[model samples]
Target: MDVELFKDGKRLDGRDVEDLRKPLKLEVGVLQKANGSAYMEWGKNKILAGVFGPKEAIPKHLANPERGVIRCIYTMSTFAGLEDHGRMGPNRRSIEISKVMREALENVVMLEKFPSTIIEVYVIVLQSEGGTRVSSLTAAAAALMDAGIPMKEPIAAVAAGKAGGKVILDLNKDEDNYGEADVPMAFTKSGDIVLFQMDGKLSKEELETAIDYGWKGTEKLFELQRKAFEEEYSEPLDKKLRMVE
Candidate 1:
Protein backbone atom coordinates (compact mmCIF):
# COMPACT_ATOMS: atom_id res chain seq x y z
CA MET A 1 0.00 0.00 0.00
CA ASP A 2 3.01 2.31 0.26
CA VAL A 3 5.00 1.54 -2.85
CA GLU A 4 6.17 4.43 -5.00
CA LEU A 5 3.87 4.87 -7.98
CA PHE A 6 6.28 6.90 -10.06
CA LYS A 7 9.82 6.35 -11.23
CA ASP A 8 11.84 8.30 -13.73
CA GLY A 9 8.98 10.81 -13.92
CA LYS A 10 6.61 8.22 -15.31
CA ARG A 11 3.93 5.90 -13.99
CA LEU A 12 4.81 2.36 -13.03
CA ASP A 13 3.35 1.35 -16.38
CA GLY A 14 5.78 3.79 -18.07
CA ARG A 15 3.01 6.13 -19.14
CA ASP A 16 3.22 9.90 -19.01
CA VAL A 17 0.62 11.49 -16.76
CA GLU A 18 -1.62 12.31 -19.72
CA ASP A 19 -1.41 8.97 -21.43
CA LEU A 20 -4.44 6.70 -21.55
CA ARG A 21 -3.60 3.03 -21.73
CA LYS A 22 -3.07 1.89 -25.29
CA PRO A 23 -5.49 -0.48 -27.05
CA LEU A 24 -8.54 1.39 -25.81
CA LYS A 25 -11.12 -0.26 -28.03
CA LEU A 26 -14.85 0.25 -28.47
CA GLU A 27 -17.42 -1.70 -30.44
CA VAL A 28 -21.19 -1.37 -30.83
CA GLY A 29 -24.13 -3.68 -31.46
CA VAL A 30 -22.42 -6.59 -29.78
CA LEU A 31 -25.57 -7.89 -28.16
CA GLN A 32 -28.28 -9.12 -30.48
CA LYS A 33 -30.95 -9.46 -27.82
CA ALA A 34 -30.65 -5.94 -26.55
CA ASN A 35 -32.03 -2.90 -28.30
CA GLY A 36 -28.52 -1.47 -28.42
CA SER A 37 -25.20 -2.74 -27.15
CA ALA A 38 -21.51 -1.92 -26.90
CA TYR A 39 -18.24 -3.35 -25.66
CA MET A 40 -15.20 -1.47 -24.42
CA GLU A 41 -11.70 -2.34 -23.36
CA TRP A 42 -9.66 0.20 -21.41
CA GLY A 43 -6.33 -0.94 -20.20
CA LYS A 44 -7.21 -4.24 -18.49
CA ASN A 45 -10.85 -3.39 -17.98
CA LYS A 46 -13.46 -4.99 -20.22
CA ILE A 47 -17.07 -3.82 -20.14
CA LEU A 48 -20.31 -4.54 -21.96
CA ALA A 49 -23.38 -2.36 -22.00
CA GLY A 50 -26.84 -2.94 -23.38
CA VAL A 51 -29.91 -0.75 -23.65
CA PHE A 52 -33.55 -1.76 -23.61
CA GLY A 53 -36.90 -0.08 -23.13
CA PRO A 54 -38.24 3.34 -23.77
CA LYS A 55 -40.91 0.70 -23.62
CA GLU A 56 -44.03 0.80 -21.50
CA ALA A 57 -43.10 1.33 -17.91
CA ILE A 58 -44.32 -1.57 -15.80
CA PRO A 59 -46.15 -0.99 -12.53
CA LYS A 60 -47.83 2.03 -14.05
CA HIS A 61 -47.86 3.97 -10.79
CA LEU A 62 -44.09 4.46 -10.84
CA ALA A 63 -43.94 5.66 -14.42
CA ASN A 64 -43.10 9.28 -14.94
CA PRO A 65 -45.82 11.07 -16.83
CA GLU A 66 -43.63 14.00 -17.86
CA ARG A 67 -40.64 12.05 -19.15
CA GLY A 68 -39.08 8.62 -19.43
CA VAL A 69 -37.15 7.38 -16.43
CA ILE A 70 -33.52 6.35 -16.70
CA ARG A 71 -32.55 3.20 -14.85
CA CYS A 72 -28.91 2.16 -14.94
CA ILE A 73 -27.97 -1.29 -13.70
CA TYR A 74 -24.25 -1.51 -13.09
CA THR A 75 -22.81 -4.90 -12.20
CA MET A 76 -19.52 -6.66 -12.17
CA SER A 77 -19.11 -10.28 -13.18
CA THR A 78 -17.88 -12.55 -10.42
CA PHE A 79 -14.60 -12.74 -12.24
CA ALA A 80 -14.35 -9.02 -12.85
CA GLY A 81 -11.51 -8.19 -10.48
CA LEU A 82 -8.55 -9.68 -8.73
CA GLU A 83 -10.81 -10.70 -5.91
CA ASP A 84 -12.14 -14.20 -5.23
CA HIS A 85 -14.99 -13.80 -7.73
CA GLY A 86 -17.60 -15.19 -5.35
CA ARG A 87 -20.04 -12.36 -4.92
CA MET A 88 -23.39 -12.44 -6.65
CA GLY A 89 -26.36 -10.16 -7.24
CA PRO A 90 -26.34 -6.44 -6.53
CA ASN A 91 -23.97 -5.65 -3.76
CA ARG A 92 -23.86 -2.36 -1.90
CA ARG A 93 -21.19 -0.98 -4.19
CA SER A 94 -22.95 -1.92 -7.38
CA ILE A 95 -26.23 -0.47 -6.11
CA GLU A 96 -24.59 2.82 -5.31
CA ILE A 97 -22.77 2.95 -8.65
CA SER A 98 -25.97 2.18 -10.49
CA LYS A 99 -27.71 5.09 -8.80
CA VAL A 100 -24.99 7.58 -9.68
CA MET A 101 -24.72 6.23 -13.22
CA ARG A 102 -28.44 6.57 -13.72
CA GLU A 103 -28.24 10.21 -12.72
CA ALA A 104 -25.38 10.84 -15.11
CA LEU A 105 -27.19 9.33 -18.11
CA GLU A 106 -30.40 11.11 -17.23
CA ASN A 107 -28.64 14.35 -18.10
CA VAL A 108 -27.66 13.35 -21.64
CA VAL A 109 -30.81 11.48 -22.68
CA MET A 110 -33.80 13.45 -23.92
CA LEU A 111 -36.14 11.50 -21.72
CA GLU A 112 -39.03 13.88 -22.20
CA LYS A 113 -39.31 12.69 -25.77
CA PHE A 114 -40.39 9.23 -24.67
CA PRO A 115 -42.82 10.03 -21.89
CA SER A 116 -44.27 7.45 -19.49
CA THR A 117 -41.75 4.76 -20.23
CA ILE A 118 -38.46 3.34 -19.04
CA ILE A 119 -35.01 3.53 -20.52
CA GLU A 120 -33.02 0.79 -18.87
CA VAL A 121 -29.28 0.64 -19.34
CA TYR A 122 -27.26 -2.36 -18.25
CA VAL A 123 -23.50 -2.09 -17.84
CA ILE A 124 -21.50 -5.14 -16.90
CA VAL A 125 -17.85 -5.20 -16.10
CA LEU A 126 -16.32 -8.35 -17.49
CA GLN A 127 -12.87 -7.56 -16.17
CA SER A 128 -11.30 -4.74 -14.19
CA GLU A 129 -7.99 -3.02 -13.86
CA GLY A 130 -9.48 0.18 -12.47
CA GLY A 131 -11.80 3.02 -13.44
CA THR A 132 -14.55 0.61 -14.35
CA ARG A 133 -17.31 3.03 -13.43
CA VAL A 134 -16.23 5.68 -15.88
CA SER A 135 -15.58 3.07 -18.54
CA SER A 136 -19.03 1.68 -17.92
CA LEU A 137 -20.47 5.13 -18.46
CA THR A 138 -18.73 5.40 -21.79
CA ALA A 139 -20.01 2.00 -22.96
CA ALA A 140 -23.55 2.71 -21.80
CA ALA A 141 -23.59 5.97 -23.66
CA ALA A 142 -22.62 4.28 -26.88
CA ALA A 143 -25.19 1.54 -26.31
CA LEU A 144 -27.88 4.13 -25.71
CA MET A 145 -27.00 5.84 -28.97
CA ASP A 146 -27.01 2.48 -30.71
CA ALA A 147 -30.55 1.95 -29.45
CA GLY A 148 -31.45 5.23 -31.19
CA ILE A 149 -32.25 6.91 -27.92
CA PRO A 150 -32.45 10.65 -28.42
CA MET A 151 -29.84 12.56 -26.51
CA LYS A 152 -28.61 16.12 -26.42
CA GLU A 153 -25.18 14.69 -27.25
CA PRO A 154 -22.90 11.80 -26.46
CA ILE A 155 -21.51 11.43 -22.94
CA ALA A 156 -18.08 10.21 -21.94
CA ALA A 157 -16.12 9.74 -18.74
CA VAL A 158 -12.58 9.26 -17.49
CA ALA A 159 -10.70 9.01 -14.23
CA ALA A 160 -7.74 11.16 -13.34
CA GLY A 161 -5.80 11.63 -10.14
CA LYS A 162 -2.87 13.11 -8.31
CA ALA A 163 -0.42 10.33 -7.78
CA GLY A 164 3.19 10.21 -6.80
CA GLY A 165 3.10 14.00 -6.59
CA LYS A 166 1.98 14.47 -10.21
CA VAL A 167 -1.41 14.85 -11.87
CA ILE A 168 -2.23 11.65 -13.67
CA LEU A 169 -4.78 11.43 -16.50
CA ASP A 170 -5.99 7.86 -16.11
CA LEU A 171 -5.59 5.69 -13.05
CA ASN A 172 -5.02 2.00 -13.49
CA LYS A 173 -5.68 -0.33 -10.56
CA ASP A 174 -2.37 0.19 -8.81
CA GLU A 175 -2.50 3.97 -9.07
CA ASP A 176 -6.06 4.08 -7.81
CA ASN A 177 -5.12 1.94 -4.87
CA TYR A 178 -2.12 4.03 -3.88
CA GLY A 179 -2.72 7.48 -5.34
CA GLU A 180 -3.11 10.57 -3.24
CA ALA A 181 -6.41 11.41 -4.82
CA ASP A 182 -8.71 9.79 -7.39
CA VAL A 183 -11.06 11.92 -9.46
CA PRO A 184 -13.50 10.49 -11.96
CA MET A 185 -15.54 12.77 -14.15
CA ALA A 186 -18.11 12.56 -16.93
CA PHE A 187 -18.67 15.19 -19.58
CA THR A 188 -20.71 15.99 -22.63
CA LYS A 189 -19.13 16.66 -26.02
CA SER A 190 -19.44 20.41 -25.38
CA GLY A 191 -17.49 20.20 -22.07
CA ASP A 192 -20.42 20.31 -19.69
CA ILE A 193 -19.64 18.27 -16.59
CA VAL A 194 -22.22 15.59 -15.88
CA LEU A 195 -20.71 13.57 -13.04
CA PHE A 196 -17.70 14.12 -10.80
CA GLN A 197 -16.55 12.06 -7.86
CA MET A 198 -13.43 12.13 -5.78
CA ASP A 199 -11.77 9.93 -3.22
CA GLY A 200 -9.00 10.93 -0.85
CA LYS A 201 -8.09 14.66 -0.92
CA LEU A 202 -6.28 17.29 -2.87
CA SER A 203 -5.31 20.95 -2.66
CA LYS A 204 -7.45 23.22 -4.79
CA GLU A 205 -4.65 23.63 -7.31
CA GLU A 206 -4.16 19.90 -7.58
CA LEU A 207 -7.90 19.41 -7.94
CA GLU A 208 -7.97 21.91 -10.78
CA THR A 209 -5.17 20.05 -12.54
CA ALA A 210 -7.04 16.77 -12.21
CA ILE A 211 -10.20 18.31 -13.64
CA ASP A 212 -8.27 19.68 -16.59
CA TYR A 213 -6.83 16.26 -17.31
CA GLY A 214 -10.23 14.65 -16.82
CA TRP A 215 -11.87 16.84 -19.46
CA LYS A 216 -9.11 16.18 -21.93
CA GLY A 217 -9.36 12.47 -21.28
CA THR A 218 -13.09 12.57 -21.90
CA GLU A 219 -12.49 14.15 -25.27
CA LYS A 220 -10.58 11.06 -26.24
CA LEU A 221 -13.28 8.80 -24.86
CA PHE A 222 -15.89 10.62 -26.98
CA GLU A 223 -13.87 10.06 -30.12
CA LEU A 224 -13.68 6.31 -29.44
CA GLN A 225 -17.43 6.36 -28.95
CA ARG A 226 -17.87 7.83 -32.41
CA LYS A 227 -15.62 5.18 -33.87
CA ALA A 228 -17.69 2.44 -32.21
CA PHE A 229 -20.69 3.53 -34.24
CA GLU A 230 -18.68 3.62 -37.41
CA GLU A 231 -17.19 0.19 -36.70
CA GLU A 232 -20.70 -1.12 -36.28
CA TYR A 233 -21.95 0.06 -39.66
CA SER A 234 -19.14 0.85 -42.07
CA GLU A 235 -18.76 -2.65 -43.47
CA PRO A 236 -22.46 -3.14 -44.02
CA LEU A 237 -22.85 0.33 -45.42
CA ASP A 238 -20.01 -0.35 -47.85
CA LYS A 239 -21.74 -3.48 -49.15
CA LYS A 240 -24.99 -1.56 -49.61
CA LEU A 241 -23.19 1.16 -51.56
CA ARG A 242 -21.48 -1.45 -53.72
CA MET A 243 -24.83 -2.99 -54.50
CA VAL A 244 -26.17 0.41 -55.51
CA GLU A 245 -23.16 0.91 -57.78
Candidate 2:
Protein backbone atom coordinates (compact mmCIF):
# COMPACT_ATOMS: atom_id res chain seq x y z
CA MET A 1 0.00 0.00 0.00
CA ASP A 2 1.47 3.40 -1.04
CA VAL A 3 -0.24 5.06 1.91
CA GLU A 4 0.56 4.40 5.53
CA LEU A 5 -2.77 3.36 6.91
CA PHE A 6 -1.77 4.16 10.44
CA LYS A 7 1.23 5.97 11.85
CA ASP A 8 1.91 7.43 15.28
CA GLY A 9 -1.76 8.35 15.91
CA LYS A 10 -3.13 9.03 12.46
CA ARG A 11 -4.04 7.35 9.19
CA LEU A 12 -3.02 8.42 5.68
CA ASP A 13 -5.74 11.07 5.77
CA GLY A 14 -4.37 12.43 9.06
CA ARG A 15 -7.50 11.35 10.94
CA ASP A 16 -7.27 9.53 14.22
CA VAL A 17 -8.23 5.87 14.10
CA GLU A 18 -11.85 6.51 15.11
CA ASP A 19 -12.47 9.76 13.29
CA LEU A 20 -14.65 9.72 10.16
CA ARG A 21 -13.95 12.02 7.24
CA LYS A 22 -15.37 15.48 7.78
CA PRO A 23 -17.92 17.44 5.76
CA LEU A 24 -20.17 14.47 4.95
CA LYS A 25 -22.79 16.17 2.81
CA LEU A 26 -26.36 15.06 2.05
CA GLU A 27 -29.14 16.61 0.00
CA VAL A 28 -32.70 15.45 -0.65
CA GLY A 29 -35.19 15.93 -3.49
CA VAL A 30 -32.52 16.40 -6.14
CA LEU A 31 -34.48 14.58 -8.84
CA GLN A 32 -37.79 16.03 -9.95
CA LYS A 33 -39.14 13.05 -11.80
CA ALA A 34 -38.45 10.43 -9.17
CA ASN A 35 -40.93 9.93 -6.37
CA GLY A 36 -38.08 10.92 -4.08
CA SER A 37 -34.30 11.30 -4.25
CA ALA A 38 -31.20 12.02 -2.26
CA TYR A 39 -27.49 12.63 -2.84
CA MET A 40 -24.58 12.03 -0.55
CA GLU A 41 -20.90 12.90 -0.60
CA TRP A 42 -18.60 11.36 1.92
CA GLY A 43 -14.97 12.19 1.51
CA LYS A 44 -14.30 11.30 -2.12
CA ASN A 45 -17.39 9.13 -2.52
CA LYS A 46 -20.43 10.59 -4.23
CA ILE A 47 -23.67 8.67 -4.63
CA LEU A 48 -27.27 9.34 -5.61
CA ALA A 49 -30.40 7.40 -4.64
CA GLY A 50 -33.86 7.61 -6.14
CA VAL A 51 -37.05 5.92 -4.98
CA PHE A 52 -40.09 5.04 -7.06
CA GLY A 53 -43.08 2.95 -6.32
CA PRO A 54 -45.74 1.54 -4.21
CA LYS A 55 -46.65 1.35 -7.82
CA GLU A 56 -47.87 -1.80 -9.51
CA ALA A 57 -45.36 -4.62 -9.47
CA ILE A 58 -44.24 -5.68 -12.92
CA PRO A 59 -44.39 -9.36 -14.01
CA LYS A 60 -47.29 -9.57 -11.55
CA HIS A 61 -45.97 -12.68 -9.81
CA LEU A 62 -43.42 -10.76 -7.74
CA ALA A 63 -46.03 -8.77 -5.90
CA ASN A 64 -47.01 -9.87 -2.42
CA PRO A 65 -50.73 -9.75 -1.75
CA GLU A 66 -50.04 -9.08 1.93
CA ARG A 67 -47.31 -6.46 1.64
CA GLY A 68 -45.26 -4.43 -0.79
CA VAL A 69 -41.91 -5.69 -2.01
CA ILE A 70 -38.71 -3.68 -1.94
CA ARG A 71 -36.32 -3.80 -4.86
CA CYS A 72 -32.92 -2.17 -4.75
CA ILE A 73 -30.43 -1.74 -7.55
CA TYR A 74 -26.91 -0.52 -6.90
CA THR A 75 -24.69 0.56 -9.78
CA MET A 76 -21.28 2.08 -10.06
CA SER A 77 -20.44 4.30 -13.01
CA THR A 78 -17.58 3.18 -15.21
CA PHE A 79 -15.62 6.27 -14.22
CA ALA A 80 -16.59 6.18 -10.56
CA GLY A 81 -13.26 4.81 -9.51
CA LEU A 82 -9.92 6.53 -9.75
CA GLU A 83 -9.57 4.60 -12.98
CA ASP A 84 -12.08 4.87 -15.84
CA HIS A 85 -12.57 1.24 -16.76
CA GLY A 86 -15.35 -0.39 -14.78
CA ARG A 87 -17.66 -2.53 -16.84
CA MET A 88 -21.28 -1.56 -17.34
CA GLY A 89 -24.32 -3.41 -15.97
CA PRO A 90 -24.84 -5.39 -12.80
CA ASN A 91 -21.88 -7.46 -11.72
CA ARG A 92 -21.79 -10.04 -8.97
CA ARG A 93 -20.58 -7.53 -6.40
CA SER A 94 -23.23 -4.97 -7.23
CA ILE A 95 -25.91 -7.63 -7.26
CA GLU A 96 -24.94 -8.83 -3.81
CA ILE A 97 -24.79 -5.29 -2.47
CA SER A 98 -28.21 -4.61 -3.93
CA LYS A 99 -29.67 -7.61 -2.14
CA VAL A 100 -28.27 -6.50 1.19
CA MET A 101 -29.40 -2.94 0.62
CA ARG A 102 -32.89 -4.12 -0.15
CA GLU A 103 -33.07 -6.17 3.03
CA ALA A 104 -31.84 -3.30 5.16
CA LEU A 105 -34.56 -0.95 4.01
CA GLU A 106 -37.26 -3.58 3.78
CA ASN A 107 -37.48 -4.11 7.49
CA VAL A 108 -38.28 -0.49 8.28
CA VAL A 109 -40.77 0.14 5.52
CA MET A 110 -44.44 -0.33 6.19
CA LEU A 111 -44.93 -2.60 3.25
CA GLU A 112 -48.24 -3.93 4.52
CA LYS A 113 -49.75 -0.56 3.82
CA PHE A 114 -49.24 -0.96 0.09
CA PRO A 115 -50.07 -4.53 -0.73
CA SER A 116 -49.40 -5.82 -4.23
CA THR A 117 -47.03 -2.99 -5.01
CA ILE A 118 -43.27 -2.50 -5.15
CA ILE A 119 -40.94 0.09 -3.77
CA GLU A 120 -37.82 0.45 -5.84
CA VAL A 121 -34.66 2.20 -4.80
CA TYR A 122 -31.92 2.89 -7.31
CA VAL A 123 -28.48 3.81 -6.02
CA ILE A 124 -25.91 5.20 -8.43
CA VAL A 125 -22.34 5.69 -7.41
CA LEU A 126 -21.01 8.63 -9.34
CA GLN A 127 -17.69 8.50 -7.52
CA SER A 128 -16.16 5.99 -5.17
CA GLU A 129 -13.32 5.94 -2.66
CA GLY A 130 -14.49 3.04 -0.45
CA GLY A 131 -17.47 2.32 1.79
CA THR A 132 -19.80 2.88 -1.12
CA ARG A 133 -22.27 0.35 0.25
CA VAL A 134 -22.77 2.29 3.44
CA SER A 135 -22.95 5.57 1.55
CA SER A 136 -25.50 4.09 -0.82
CA LEU A 137 -27.61 2.70 2.01
CA THR A 138 -27.60 6.04 3.79
CA ALA A 139 -28.80 7.81 0.69
CA ALA A 140 -31.39 5.12 0.01
CA ALA A 141 -32.93 5.63 3.42
CA ALA A 142 -33.12 9.36 2.82
CA ALA A 143 -34.71 8.80 -0.56
CA LEU A 144 -37.34 6.54 0.98
CA MET A 145 -38.22 9.22 3.49
CA ASP A 146 -38.35 11.84 0.78
CA ALA A 147 -40.71 9.57 -1.14
CA GLY A 148 -43.09 9.69 1.84
CA ILE A 149 -42.87 5.99 2.42
CA PRO A 150 -44.17 5.07 5.82
CA MET A 151 -41.34 3.69 7.89
CA LYS A 152 -40.68 2.78 11.48
CA GLU A 153 -37.52 4.86 11.40
CA PRO A 154 -34.67 5.85 9.15
CA ILE A 155 -31.71 3.53 8.71
CA ALA A 156 -28.07 4.52 8.96
CA ALA A 157 -24.93 2.68 7.96
CA VAL A 158 -21.20 2.90 8.53
CA ALA A 159 -17.98 0.94 8.15
CA ALA A 160 -15.62 0.18 11.00
CA GLY A 161 -12.55 -1.99 10.99
CA LYS A 162 -9.27 -3.14 12.44
CA ALA A 163 -6.23 -1.15 11.35
CA GLY A 164 -2.79 -1.57 12.89
CA GLY A 165 -4.40 -3.92 15.39
CA LYS A 166 -6.80 -1.20 16.54
CA VAL A 167 -10.52 -1.01 15.84
CA ILE A 168 -11.30 2.15 13.93
CA LEU A 169 -14.42 3.87 12.67
CA ASP A 170 -14.96 4.60 8.97
CA LEU A 171 -12.45 3.26 6.47
CA ASN A 172 -11.36 5.30 3.47
CA LYS A 173 -10.02 3.64 0.36
CA ASP A 174 -6.45 3.25 1.55
CA GLU A 175 -7.43 2.00 4.98
CA ASP A 176 -9.94 -0.41 3.52
CA ASN A 177 -7.41 -1.83 1.13
CA TYR A 178 -4.55 -2.02 3.62
CA GLY A 179 -6.28 -2.38 6.96
CA GLU A 180 -6.44 -5.74 8.68
CA ALA A 181 -10.24 -5.95 8.51
CA ASP A 182 -13.39 -4.07 7.49
CA VAL A 183 -16.89 -4.41 8.92
CA PRO A 184 -19.80 -2.58 7.36
CA MET A 185 -22.97 -2.31 9.41
CA ALA A 186 -26.41 -0.72 9.14
CA PHE A 187 -28.92 -0.02 11.86
CA THR A 188 -32.30 1.54 12.39
CA LYS A 189 -32.65 4.73 14.40
CA SER A 190 -33.56 2.59 17.37
CA GLY A 191 -30.23 0.71 17.19
CA ASP A 192 -31.51 -2.44 15.59
CA ILE A 193 -28.84 -3.92 13.36
CA VAL A 194 -30.36 -4.68 9.99
CA LEU A 195 -27.16 -5.38 8.08
CA PHE A 196 -23.66 -6.51 8.95
CA GLN A 197 -20.81 -7.72 6.78
CA MET A 198 -17.21 -8.40 7.59
CA ASP A 199 -14.16 -8.67 5.37
CA GLY A 200 -10.90 -9.87 6.81
CA LYS A 201 -10.08 -11.40 10.18
CA LEU A 202 -10.76 -10.22 13.67
CA SER A 203 -10.60 -11.71 17.13
CA LYS A 204 -13.62 -11.82 19.43
CA GLU A 205 -12.57 -8.69 21.29
CA GLU A 206 -11.74 -6.87 18.07
CA LEU A 207 -15.08 -7.87 16.61
CA GLU A 208 -16.94 -6.47 19.58
CA THR A 209 -14.94 -3.28 19.43
CA ALA A 210 -15.59 -2.91 15.76
CA ILE A 211 -19.33 -3.38 16.27
CA ASP A 212 -19.34 -0.74 18.97
CA TYR A 213 -17.52 1.64 16.74
CA GLY A 214 -19.91 0.83 13.94
CA TRP A 215 -22.90 1.67 16.13
CA LYS A 216 -21.37 4.96 17.15
CA GLY A 217 -20.69 5.82 13.55
CA THR A 218 -24.23 4.96 12.60
CA GLU A 219 -25.56 7.19 15.36
CA LYS A 220 -23.74 10.09 13.78
CA LEU A 221 -25.05 9.05 10.39
CA PHE A 222 -28.63 8.99 11.71
CA GLU A 223 -28.20 12.55 12.92
CA LEU A 224 -27.02 13.56 9.49
CA GLN A 225 -30.02 11.82 7.96
CA ARG A 226 -32.31 13.83 10.19
CA LYS A 227 -30.43 16.99 9.37
CA ALA A 228 -31.07 16.39 5.70
CA PHE A 229 -34.79 16.29 6.35
CA GLU A 230 -34.63 19.43 8.47
CA GLU A 231 -32.85 21.24 5.69
CA GLU A 232 -35.33 19.91 3.18
CA TYR A 233 -38.23 21.32 5.17
CA SER A 234 -36.63 24.54 6.34
CA GLU A 235 -36.64 26.71 3.25
CA PRO A 236 -34.65 29.89 3.78
CA LEU A 237 -36.52 33.17 3.86
CA ASP A 238 -34.21 34.66 1.24
CA LYS A 239 -35.12 31.97 -1.25
CA LYS A 240 -38.80 32.39 -0.47
CA LEU A 241 -38.51 36.18 -0.84
CA ARG A 242 -36.73 35.74 -4.19
CA MET A 243 -39.63 33.56 -5.33
CA VAL A 244 -42.04 36.27 -4.22
CA GLU A 245 -39.99 38.92 -6.05
- What TM-score would every model get versus the actual structure? 0.94, 0.93
lDDT measured at residue 212 in model 1 versus the true structure, 0 to 100: 93
lDDT (Cα, 0-100) at 10 in candidate 2 = 76
Give the count of colliding residue pairs in each prediction. Answer: 0, 0
Give the Cα-based TM-score of candidate 2 against the true structure. Answer: 0.93
How good is model 1 by TM-score? 0.94
User: Which runs in model 2 stand beyond 4 Å of their true positions?
Assistant: 1-3, 236-245
For candidate 2, the 10 contiguous residues with the lowest summed lDDT are 236-245
Which regions in candidate 1 have their CA more than 4 angstroms from the true location? 237-245
Please write out the lDDT profile of model 1 over residues 1-245, one tens digit for every residue.
Answer: 67899898888999999999877999888886788888999999999999998899887876998999988899999999998767758989899889888999999899989889998999999999999999999999999999999999999999988888888998999899988889988999998898899998989998898899898888888889988777777776321122233
lDDT of 1 at 154: 95
Question: Scored by CA lDDT, what does every candidate get?
Answer: 0.89, 0.89
Lowest-sum lDDT 10-residue window in model 1: 236-245
Candidate 2 lDDT, 215-240, residue by residue in tens:
88888888898898898889852222
